[model samples]
Target: MDSILFIEIESSYKAIPLLVFKRDHHSSIIKKSHVRIYSDAHALLMAIEEQVQEFQKLIEQQTIQMIEDKERELNEHISHLQASAIHQLTLSQQQWFEKAEEQLNKLLDAQEKRLSEAIADARNSMASAIRNRLIKMNQSDSLIGYLSDALHAELNDVEKSLVIVKSYSDNGTTLTIENDDCMVSINTQELLSELKSCLENISDD
Candidate 1:
């Protein structure tokens, strides 16, 4: 085995090579002194130490750079995730609103249909009641007699003679009075029209 010896120079605070020793097969130690060889060896060791320090610094710089790149990538990914989440939430809210509006429109349409049916039923019931009442009045003999007397009073001044007639049919009643110069007729339809107008006026009041 061969061994290298190092000695420190107090002026430069650097380690310099001093001697090389080796053992022969007989276990005898031999020492060789060569100042130029030892100086070259010391310079080589210093260059190797400098290279190792430079490599360590480079590794530290690369590590820092890698950490920064990873951090930047993570931040970008987080931002993308947040943007996607917001878009999804907005889409969900829009869908909910559309569904709610559709339901509301259907509800309103159903209510409108029901209301229209109710109005139609009420109109039919009222018309039937009016028609039955009018039929009863038409069958009464007292009503015919009263109408005749009223026509006689109205036509006293203008007529040579007046004839009054009462008629009843499925459509309703008709009252007719005729003279030589003029004729007048009244029907249940005309009475119904007058009654509707009066009812509208009363509602407005």
Candidate 2:
């Protein structure tokens, strides 16, 4: 009779698809098989081998289930974080863009206002200059006529025979006159200055 015994068995797996979820392809399996006895063994040894295979299958199934759950949870968490970050970035960019546009519009408005004022000032200054030039031109023509007419009219008027040429200066107008009693001489600038002083004193009063 054989007192010691030896036994051998095989173990493997076959994937089974779970059809519970319509959109997700999740897979799980419940393995079941009759042990094939390769060599005759004692009853005690056969029982131990069966228990070991069952234990191994249960451990493998539990471990794979845990790993799949953890991986799915991790992927979902990462995707959520990425989406949240993108949303926050978009919001921040929109806020900054609005602020920048507002500031730019304000600057443009201020610049336009300054430009308008400057253009108005330039127009006013140009109008003033043109008016002054016209007034000065009229005054100059009148003064020239008066100076020439004074000398010509006085010289042409019939009086006496004697004639006198008066003093001359480069700064102002010169006049010549002849009369019956005495030919008089005068500087018109001094007379005009005295007349202007008298008018100014009257205006002050």
Candidate 3:
């Protein structure tokens, strides 16, 4: 017999499926044996997660490089504009300004799209990992804490530029591990490390 348990996070939360098995049976013995298998699965998941994070970081780095190139082009255009501004403010200067503005806008849009896609990919992977942890711990009473530790380990290996973006209610907070030069006060990486340590301690308890 297959038993399913559905757990909901909240009213807006989707229910997750977990298996149930009766204790003191042969199947229960097999369940205990499966601990080793789950450990193996955990290792495999971590490897896969590392590869995925590497790929994401590569993409992000490439995107940043492309942005830097675009910024150089924009700077050149601005310089040309400034030079033209010194002249009689001709129609040709207006045309150049319009074209430069259009290109800048396009580049900005593309950069934003790339960032959004990368974040979405990370979120999906994280959610899948959480689901797998829950499924593996179906019969265990203390699953959340264990899963939290696993996530912390995973996060430790991720790039400083990428952090998990989660939504509370309808608002979203992007917890970036990278330091932004624009905002010196937000030391997100340190904050995340402390948070992970707390979660791991909870898991140990």
> Which candidate has the top score in TM-score?
1
Model 1 over residues 65-153: C-alpha lDDT tens digits? 99999999999999999999999999999999999999999999999999988877776667667656655765466656666676677
Cα lDDT listed for each candidate: 0.69, 0.59, 0.54
Clashes of each: 0, 0, 0
Worst 10-residue lDDT window for candidate 1 reads 13-22
Candidate 3 per-residue C-alpha lDDT over 1-205 given as tens digits, one digit per residue, 9 for 90 to 100? 9995443334421231123323455432324334445557668989999999999999999999999999999999999989888775677788899999999999999999999888777766665565555445443424333433444455563333434332222221222222333221222234344555554454444
Candidate 2 residue pairs in clash (backbone atoms < 3 Å): none
The TM-score, computed over Cα atoms with residue i paired to residue i, of candidate 2 is: 0.43
| Model 3 / residue 108 / CA error / Å | 58
Tens digits of per-residue lDDT for model 2 on 1-205?
8664333323431221223213323522222222222222335577998998999999999999999999999999999999999999999999999999999999999999999888777766665565454435333546545654565556665443444454455434445566654454445555455555554454344
TM-score head-to-head 2 vs 3, winner: 2
User: What is the overall TM-score of model 3 with all chains considered together?
Assistant: 0.29
What lDDT is reached at residue 43 by model 1?
A: 92
TM-scores for candidates 1 onward, in order = 0.61, 0.43, 0.29
As for lDDT, the candidate ahead, 1 or 2, is: 1
Off by over 4 Å in 3: 1-27, 31-33, 89-205
